[model samples]
Target: MITEEYLMQKLSRTMSEKLLRHARGVADTAEKLAKKYGTDPFKARIAGLLHDIARDFDDNEMLQRAKKYNLTVSEYGFAMPLLLHGPVAAVMAREDYGINDQEILNAIALHTVGSEYMSQLDKIIFVADKIEPNRKHAGVEGIRRQANVNLEAALLSCFDESIRYVLKMGFLLHPTSVKARNSLLVDQGSFRK
Candidate 1:
């Protein structure tokens, strides 16, 4: 198990204070979600602590760092390198922090753009990143409440919110997020919203 002290030591050396605070918030939120949803809270907390390890990197740096890893950048990722932070951080989490759990790595990598087939831990980390206490947005509180009731529903709301944000910014909406949202709706057998 990765101790909080160990994570803080590693993070403090590479992350900004603001980023550390966000990571702490995500860790706490992920643990709570994992406990609520009957998953491994330890994995959730560990993934959360390391999820944004490369978030402070600039756009070019994000791309550069990703190349050093085993990951391939998607078309959307090339267009928006900001999305590469998760994948880059995943590599860092594995290499620098010596984390070997695929579940935690996937959670870190998928937290930014989400995935079509998200594990329970993946959903926990993803939703926790959005609803963590340090986060502030329009419908975040509603999403937080929704997360406690239904993880998938909260994930759907998050997808909806992300899509809305992309549209608002006139950015390309990544198909992965769209597919993820559609998958949730399809499973639910409705798409009224």
Candidate 2:
């Protein structure tokens, strides 16, 4: 039940200009992807705009807020509380913005690490977050192109990109991400399960 004007007002007042810019970019990207994928563009935009509502919070704050929001954090989330931002913000979108749409909320929640079973809307937001104009990385343009053509292809690319980055950075690859990528691979019948 949130309007674009209201969402922008809340985000701008609390978030840094940098985060706001990223949010806007994600919103635009999500909307475009949603339209292309036959999902609701308004819902996608709302989810995208609020996806990172808690991204800037400090690590401890993320942990605390995760509990306050009643999100059960995994060991991975406890170790890397940044992962909790998505879920925390999903709750914020519900409690603060009065958004009761589970689909939009799930898209926001899983945008960080991804889930094994993702809807088209979830795939759209995840891909949009990575391919948004504000994002910069190796092969992002190619991934963006893939997103416009195929959501699952774009999702696989995004997952591969994330895995590569995590390996390069020596970070533990979250299991959810692994399962998500594997789910797609299995569905394609290309990987031995």
Candidate 3:
């Protein structure tokens, strides 16, 4: 099994100190949520730690990595280049880092633009990335508080914020994001809203 130390070493060498610390914070938050939600802590840790692995790479590097992994680059991913990092990192984690777990890869892949069939670990990593202690935003506190009570609800809140932000910024919305929101809304019986 790949150890946390190994992952940390790789992360430290590739990312700036600030980004590395953020990754660690996300890992810690993911572990806490995993314990609370009865999810696997190991998977949560890996997902959180590697969620932003592609951030340090430039656009060409990101695209190369994505192509190397056969990830389809969508119009939304192109417009919002940061969105490609998640899926690219997922591929790098598996192909380069030798991470063979599908759940972990999926969690990393969908952290940015979540999908309808996200697993518990996926939801945990996604929420942890958005609401880690170091994060500051207008409504972050509310999402953080909701995470403790209802993971799904917290995801809904986070996705809603993301959607609003994208719309306000005039960024193209990813279809996966919309599907993710719809999936959560359906689960909450608020799909019509």
Candidate 4:
């Protein structure tokens, strides 16, 4: 089992100072959310810390790692190589960090683009990544407020923001994100507010 300190050291070596701070912020937020939602705080913290492990890779490096790991890359993912980092990070977490927990791996993998049916841990990590203390997006406060009342509602709000941000940036929307949002809307039985 890899210790949290060891993971932090690994992250320090791989990420820039700003990114390391962001990872710490995510980890703290994820740990708190895990406690609030009655999940394992340790797992949430670890997953949050490692979620962006491969984020610093350049386009070619991301594509190379994705191919090396045999990940199924979507067209948007190819265009936006950053999207490939999540799955690549997951594989790295397992192989290099010796993190064998599927829930933790899934949280790391699905944090950027949520899954169809998000587990509680997945929701925690995703929300924490968005609403961490360092994040200052326009809708962040609203989602943080919703996070206190309902996990799913906050997740939906976060996803909505993500979709809009992608659209505004002229980036192709990843189908995984759309499907995750659709699943949440269906599960909640509601449309865009």
Candidate 5:
């Protein structure tokens, strides 16, 4: 098993200072949510810490990394390679970091643009990345508060904010995010409570 120290050292070497802080914040928040939701706190922390491991890559580097890992990219991913960082980091966390745990990898991969029927660890990482202490936004507090009550509701709230930000900034809306929202709202009946 890879120790937290090893992961932290790798993160320190690979990420910029600002990103390193964000990763720590996400890990802290993920662990807290994991405990509250009765998931594995260790897995949550590891996924959160390594979720942004590939975030510093430039466009070319991002593509090369994806190719190296045989990870497919959509047209939007090619246009905005930053979005592929989650997938790329997932690959790295497996091959480079010797993380063979599927739950951790899935959480890291889906953290950026979530997928349908996300596992508890996946939801924890996603919400943690969005509502971590370093993050400041209009609806973060609401999501943070909701997180304590309902994990799925917090995910829905976070996705709503993310979609709004994408529209406001004129960024391409990834279909995965839309599907994630739809699944939470419609398929999962997440808001029924």
Candidate 6:
């Protein structure tokens, strides 16, 4: 397990502070969700902390890192710059940061453009990222409320919102996001509201 101090040291000063605070917020949210759903708090915290490790990087740098780490960048990622960060972050988290845990890496990789086989930690980070305290959106408060009530329901809401937002912006939806929604729908019986 990488120490928090070591993780902070690896980040740039500005990114370190911002990511640390965000990580803490995600951790808090993750812990709450984990407790509610009977998942592991420690795993949730690690997933939350590392989810955005590549968020601060620019498009060119992100692609470079992705290539360096031999991450299989999807066509969607190539067309849409925003989607590249998560998978790139996963690779960097493993190769650069020496975090070899597959579950943690998968959580980071799929947090943005989620996948079909998302683990519990993946769901925790995905929902936590959307509902973290600093996030302000039209229905974020409602989503957070739903998260408190039911984690699966919260994820359904979040995934629906994410897809709608992406389509509204005239961007191509990553297939992984669709797969995630389908998987969740199978688990939760479709998104509501």
Off by over 4 Å in 5: 188-193
Please write out the lDDT profile of model 4 over residues 1-193, one tens digit for every residue.
6789999988888889988999999999999999999999999999999998999999999999999999998887888999888899999999988899999999999998888978999999999999999999998999999999899999999999999999999998888899999998888889666
lDDT against the true structure, per candidate, is 0.91, 0.92, 0.90, 0.92, 0.93, 0.81
lDDT of 1 at 183: 94
The segments of candidate 6 whose C-alpha lies over 4 angstroms from its true place after superposition are 12-19, 190-193
TM per candidate comes to: 0.96, 0.97, 0.95, 0.96, 0.95, 0.89
Top-lDDT structure, candidate number: 5
**lDDT tens string, model 3, 6-110?**
999888888899898899999999999999999999889988999898988887787777777888888776666778999898888987787999999999998
Candidate 6, position 167, lDDT = 86
How many clashes show up in model 1? Answer: 0
lDDT (Cα) of model 2:
0.92
In terms of lDDT, which candidate is stronger, 1 or 5?
5
**Top candidate by TM-score:** 2
**Model 3 worst lDDT window (10 residues):** 74-83
The weakest ten consecutive residues by lDDT in model 6 span 7-16
Error of 4 at 150 (Å): 0.7
**What value does the lDDT take at residue 134 in candidate 6?**
78
Instruction: Give me the displacement of residue 19 in model 2, in angstroms.
Output: 0.6
The clash tally of candidate 2 reads 0
Regions of candidate 1 where Cα sits further than 4 Å from its true position: none
Tell me model 4's lDDT, rounded to 2 decimals: 0.92
